[model samples]
Target: MVALILILVGCNSGKKGEAAAEQKNPKCKVETSLFGMTPEGDSVMLYTLKNEQDITVTITNYGGIITGIYIPDKNGKTTNITLGFDNLEQYLAGHPNFGALIGRYGNRIANARFSLDGETYTLAANNGNNSLHGGVKGFDDVTWVPEVISCDERAALRLSYLSVDGEEGYPGNLSVTVTYELLMDQLFITYEAECDKATVLNLTNHAYFNLAGEGSIRDHILYI
Candidate 1:
């Protein structure tokens, strides 16, 4: 089950036009701060992820989304290498790829319904008669209280959310904590949860990457 969670949760677009845009203005020095919020008052924070080489990644608390990744290519030039929408509205609308935290059962459970104990429970069908990430509002879509951790070398933002009973048709109230730690070369994610009643839980962040730092990684190289 954890393996499945790793797949959906464990982890973009333009190239030419992007280079032109970057030439106009080199990106500012990477920084960390509170970005903004939703009309509903949900808080969003941003973190800068740096690699051993000082390559950077910009991530936001909104849906735990990755807004940008600046990596040094073979030539040592920094390029924003991840795919994502320009703003929160686009993210709220929908996303096929880019970055998103998945939850309440990361993958399909067959027919958007499951049987727990002696009773059967049905979930909202958000994905073709199936439930995708705890119905309409999953853990990824909620705001979490954030704690920023830092050191001279790296940084992390610990985030957590509480899911109420009947939220997205799931049983039991669940308290979940997810951590985003930026290490030298990897964004280590930790997800922990507890529930008052029996329920299913799956969590992962969807982030496509190209370690080489350019182009679609699908054709770059893949194993498993």
Candidate 2:
């Protein structure tokens, strides 16, 4: 039987934007702590979500990154099933998207430029001639304000970020919110956003999972 399941919600906004097997009744829990401090002396926090099934997901405000995800196997053994660093320094140093929240534009814009209503805007071209994942800094590199919400059914961490106009060459001031919820044997993510002006916007979570607990997924079966 398969061991772990990682669900990622990638949200893309163009200006406007489940249950598991039965077991012992366990209450969902959420814990927050200081993850680290940025070079600019900003404090970053880590929020951990634990479900009734003992599955745990750790996320940090720095870049809105999912630092870790722990899931149990059929044998009742738990292990972290995602790739990431142990500290904020490593994340700041750089790595693949790991488990970052990509935004403004998730993919790319050709030539790092776009036109709207006969007006042209130029963006940062970190990915060759195209603008990749928002831009050089993107949403992945910014700090988000976090709010923890809990109820009888689940616990959630709601993170919010405001992208100002002219930032990364985007036209409008965008307000974004992403919530991560822990329920029975599952993780739910929700993303919402609004912009003051008409501007291009897209958002997504880049999380890589390893179901077997280690190694390449070459031997695993995928069903799209």
What are the lDDT scores of the predictions, listed in order? 0.64, 0.79
Q: After superposition, how far is residue 64 of candidate 1 from its true place, in Å?
A: 1.1
Q: Which candidate wins on TM-score?
A: 2
Residue 124, candidate 1: C-alpha displacement in angstroms:
1.4
Please state the error at residue 24 of candidate 2 in Å. Answer: 16
Runs in model 2 deviating more than 4 A are 1-26
Superposed model 1: Cα runs more than 4 Å off: 1-31, 211-218
- Give all TM-scores, in the order shown: 0.77, 0.87
Colliding residue pairs in candidate 1: 9-204, 9-205, 12-83
Root mean square deviation (Cα) for candidate 1: 9.2
